[model samples]
Target: MIRGPVIETPRLILRPPLAEDLDGFCELMADEDAAKFIGGLQPRAAVWRTLCMMSGAWSIRGFSMFSVIEKSTGNWIGRLGPWQPEGWPGTEVGWGLLTLAQGRGYAAEGASAAMDYAVDSLGFTEIIHCIDPKNAPSIKLAERLGSRKLGEAVAPAPIPHTVWDVYGQTADTWRARRLE
Candidate 1:
């Protein structure tokens, strides 16, 4: 098993995906609205594949989305962090959370820490978030993270028909922003 880093913020714990996280991950992806931007509603079997994919990525590439846990409740809330799947647009620090976890500023808090890890530890000089064009909430969050709209790009094979508005910042820019 991949022993990934355990990152703690004020209210959340970010760690690698585990077998036990399946239930919460399924719950999050089953909700229409919550899963809409991340991906359409996924069935249990598909969610299982996704969970395995994340785990496999950790084993194969040494990094993948972290299974997010709410510190106070210790509940598996969602997953978010470094992600660079095959045919990806760029090195990314993406996020997806359970519905109840939204509107809580948790994405920003968690994403900041993930971005730090990707840059400082993983040597990623640039980080991007590939967001759907209509995902205003995500667009807002990306902006909040100091990522500016870079341009649009067609999504990879599985979603090639979909075009995304890419937003990002270089490590130098990210570091400069952090000092402010």
Candidate 2:
């Protein structure tokens, strides 16, 4: 079985999803506003499936989003990390936090660690974030992470998303940005 690595940031612990996180994960995906840019709100059952999928991804792909735990409260705050399913647009490090967790810079902190792992550990040459055109917050976050809008592409259908704004930087660029 594949095991996820536990990654720690200044104020958060990035670890594999646990059964204890089900409620928070459900709440995040159930909120229309929270799920808007990522995907629309889903029923509890769907959310459970999603959680299982993320867990399964670790074993199947050896890499998946890390569950973000707030060090202060020990609560599950969100999930962010490397993700690349079959036929995915590209190697990616994505983020999605609870609505209450927005604007705290947790996404940036956790994602930075994930990106480092993607490059330095996984040996990925590039990383991308497939963002919806209308997601201003995510777009801003992508920019904050030194990723520029690379272009747009059609996502696989039935996902209800239109042309996606792909933002990314090469490994060299990522390293250079981190140094600055």
Candidate 3:
């Protein structure tokens, strides 16, 4: 089994999903607004499957999104990190935070840490964030992270999403951004 690493940020802890995180994960996945960009509201059963898929990824792929926990409240606030499944467009570091966790810069903080791990530890040469064009907030965050719109691509089927805006930067650029 893959031993997921614990990544600590200034105000968040990025770790593998635990069984206790089911409630928080389900709650976020159930929120229409919060789940809109990622995927529309999912049933509890679907969320359970997703949780299982995420945890399974660590064992099967040796990497997956890290569960974001608020350091102060010890809450599972979101999930963000390295993600690249079969048929995926490219290597990506993604993020999704609950509505309650919005506007706090946690997505940025957690995503930054994830990217660092991806490029430095995992030796990823490039990273991307697949975002819906209508997702202005995510677009802004991607830009803030120094990723520009590279192009558009169709997402996997059954999701009803089309022409995702792909924002990305190379590892060299990521390193330069860190030094700035």
Alpha-carbon lDDT, every model: 0.92, 0.89, 0.92
lDDT by residue (tens digit), candidate 2, 130-165: 999899999999999999999987777556546799
Candidate with the larger TM-score of 2 and 3: 3
| TM-scores for candidates 1 onward, in order | 0.97, 0.95, 0.96
Q: For model 3, how does the per-residue alpha-carbon lDDT over 1-180 read when each residue is reduced to its tens digit?
A: 325999999999999887788899999998999998887799989998888889988999989999999999999999999998776789999999999999999999999999999999989999999999999999999999999999987887655656799999999999999889
- Candidate 1 wrongly placed segments (more than 4 Å): none
lDDT of 2: 0.89
Q: Which runs in model 2 stand beyond 4 Å of their true positions? A: none
The worst-scoring run of ten residues by lDDT in candidate 1 lies at 153-162
* RMSD (CA, angstroms), candidate 1: 1.0
lDDT of 3 at 166: 96
lDDT, residue 14, model 2:
91
Query: Judged by lDDT against the true structure, how good is candidate 1?
Result: 0.92
Please rank every candidate by TM-score, starting with the best: 1, 3, 2
Candidate 3: deviation at residue 21, Å? 0.9
